[model samples]
Target chain A: MNPTACILVIGNEILSGRTQDVNVQYIARRLAELGITLAEVRIIPDRRPVIVDTIVAARAAFDHVFTTGGIGPTHDDITAPCVAEAFGLPWVIHPETFRLLEAHFPQGEFNAARQRMATLPQGAVPIPNPVSSAPGFSIGNVHVLAGVPRIMRAMFEELAPSLRHGTPVASQSWHALGLYEGALAAGLTDIQERFPGLDIGSYPFRRPDGRGGVTLVSKGLDPAQVRAAADAVQALIAQLGCTPIEGEPPP
Target chain B: MNPTACILVIGNEILSGRTQDVNVQYIARRLAELGITLAEVRIIPDRRPVIVDTIVAARAAFDHVFTTGGIGPTHDDITAPCVAEAFGLPWVIHPETFRLLEAHFPQGEFNAARQRMATLPQGAVPIPNPVSSAPGFSIGNVHVLAGVPRIMRAMFEELAPSLRHGTPVASQSWHALGLYEGALAAGLTDIQERFPGLDIGSYPFRRPDGRGGVTLVSKGLDPAQVRAAADAVQALIAQLGCTPIEGEPPP
Candidate 1:
């Protein structure tokens, strides 16, 4: 069975609609490639009680819980403290992190705020950030990463090797222009019933230039089953008098 | 008090990381303009029990619950039935929706899948879709809309006036190039302490071209308090010897 994961995005900027989140999609794709099922994603404000409660709950519910944002040196960066509270562990500065950060910053410049970045929950292991000096950390099932895209990507790479991977989940899709979803829904349902383990989805797309199409997708851990389902989808498109095109349509 | 709202995005494409969601940000921005506090956003798959449970919980917790996706004519479109189960209402065909859909489709083309779009829960009031003929519905506080952005935007615009709005929340931000977050964290915390009512946030941005900066933001219902906090942020930027930019930097 594939490991299940949840992403908790703790930030006021995302909730306030002041910032667009790109982290969730990036992490979701990576987790998929690593054979983990991305079960749920929650975006919440940077409230202390909310953060602590959510961390406690999510850590128990999924095999892995990735938290992004609220780990900066600013006053609003309360994720580290909240995580410590969640695990009933003391928040302390890691010796290695402190050393690395202190050396990275200029003399007399590593203030209390900068020092906060080096602090982690007890028994936590650091995930080094290649883009930035300060590191992210992992405590138990919860992996904490920075909010910045570049730093977050680097931190994820550092921690990816430690994660347990199942059979890599993959998908195949076929699209046919001018083929409407309602026209192919019945035949698609038959294909889905045949392959109960696979997730067969039918999506209808409409472009701004009035061009539209229907894309049928099949996804599962087994590549053979996924491809067989896609073959059925391709046949269905042909049966409906629309030429089946492999993969997504033109942008 | 502001009426709190939660968004439930129901789809497989989003969870699979196959689609990058633009709907959540659009709805969030609209809710902010209408003075609604977007407390939470949850992205979940098109599962029956999960959708039913989430709808029940979110409806009870917040003043408004907005759901996007799974209202189309495909087999994956299970949101209508799940919502019916959530409310414990019979999944019935609304007479008005049935008539509109029947009139919209050509002769002999409104199949079972197409007809599914018209089948709403009992006591559902239709929210018209200007982009397409099929209407979304509002049953209780849960407003179910389409997954497609163009259609969803039109539906939200139609339903916007009906929603209860509070004092419009606003925000002001000042950014500074080459200003690190650690340098201004203490001063920003002091500013936050002075204006306890406002949410003052410090964000660090890194560009691909190697130019990095910090953006300080203040947000609240009262424009005066928001502006006052932003003024303090600008002063802090100047004290650090970086030019205080009036707003977000260029993309």
Candidate 2:
């Protein structure tokens, strides 16, 4: 069984549509490589109550939970304290974090606002940021991360080694132009039913020039089963008078 | 108060890292323009129980609930039936949708698999799809749309005017190069406190060349308050000895 994970994007920017979020897709891909099932992804506001409640719920529900945004120096950056409140722990200044931050900043420049970055939940473990000096942290199952894509990527790559590994899911696909999903659905169902373990999917897409295509995918932990299902789908598409093109359609 | 909305993206492709989803951003911007607050966004897999439960919960929690994906002919496309189960209504074929889809296909091509596209929850109002004839539907507050970005955009635009409009939220931003967040955090907090109605945000970004900057935004329904907050942010940036650039930083 794959260890399930959830990503909580605690940013008003994304929810407001002011920002295009690339963090979720980046983390989702990383988790797949690590064999952790990306079960859920949420983009939520920086509201304290929402963050606290979601953190508590997500931690209890999934094997791992990652949160991006709200760990900055600004007032909206309330995630660290909210996480502490959720865990029923003291929001304290870690000596090492405080010292590292204090030393990094120029003399007398690390004001009370910058010091907020040093304060974390009592039991939190700092996830180092190579892009910026400010560190994200983890408390139990929830990993706090930066909202910026570059910083978030650095933090996750640093913290990823600590997460539990599961069986890696492999995928095989066959796609073809002029292949309607309705025409392929029946044969696809038969393939799925025959190999119950593999998840067979039919995705229809229309190209820019008004050409339509369908991509048939077989995905599972077992590579052999996925490959076999892909073969069946390829044959099925050929039977429908469309030439099967292996792999995903071009962007 | 603006009407609140939650967008549910139900797709294994998104979770599996096989696809990057643009549907959420597109819907979120539209909802904002319609004076609706996009409070939350969830990306869940193509699972029956999860879809039904999420639909029930989201519809009850938000004023409008929009779902994308899994309304296709494939076996994994269980959204339509699950929506019916959530509302405690029977899933039945809609006569108008059936007629349109049947006519769209050639003779005998409207098989059982293709006919599934015509199925809808009891009392569903079909939302016309200009890109593809297979119509999406709105049952209660939950509007079920397609996963495909092009089709979803067409469907949402057709159905957008029917949504209840609140005070449209507008935004004003001030950004500048080499402006660090810690330097702006204090004054930004004061600005936020002064204009409690406006949502003040401070976002830091690092360019590919390693040049860092900050974008400060003030958003709210009141144009005067939003503008005042933006002005204050501009002044705050100047106070830190940096020239303030009006509007958001360039991508």
The TM-score leader among the candidates is 1
Clashing pairs in 1: none
Tens digits of per-residue lDDT for model 1 on B1-251? 89999999999888888888888889988888999999999999988998999999999999999999999888789999999999999999888888888988899998898899999999999999877799899999999999988899999999999999998887888988898999999999999998999899888876889888888888999999998888898899899998888866423
* Candidate 2, position B130, lDDT: 90
TM-score of each: 0.98, 0.97
Per-candidate DockQ values are 0.82, 0.80
| Native-referenced DockQ of model 1 | 0.82
Candidate 1 structure quality by residue, lDDT tens digits, A1-251? 99999999999888877788999989988998999999999999999998999899999999999999998999999999999999999999999999999999999999999999999998999999887788889999999999987789889989999998888886998987898888999999999999999999988887779899888889999999999999999999999999998876423
Q: Local distance difference test, per candidate?
A: 0.91, 0.90
Deviation from native of the Cα of residue B250 in model 2, angstroms: 3.2
Single out the weakest 10-residue window by summed lDDT for candidate 2 chain B. Answer: B242-251
Question: Would candidate 1 be rated incorrect, acceptable, medium or high by CAPRI criteria?
Answer: high
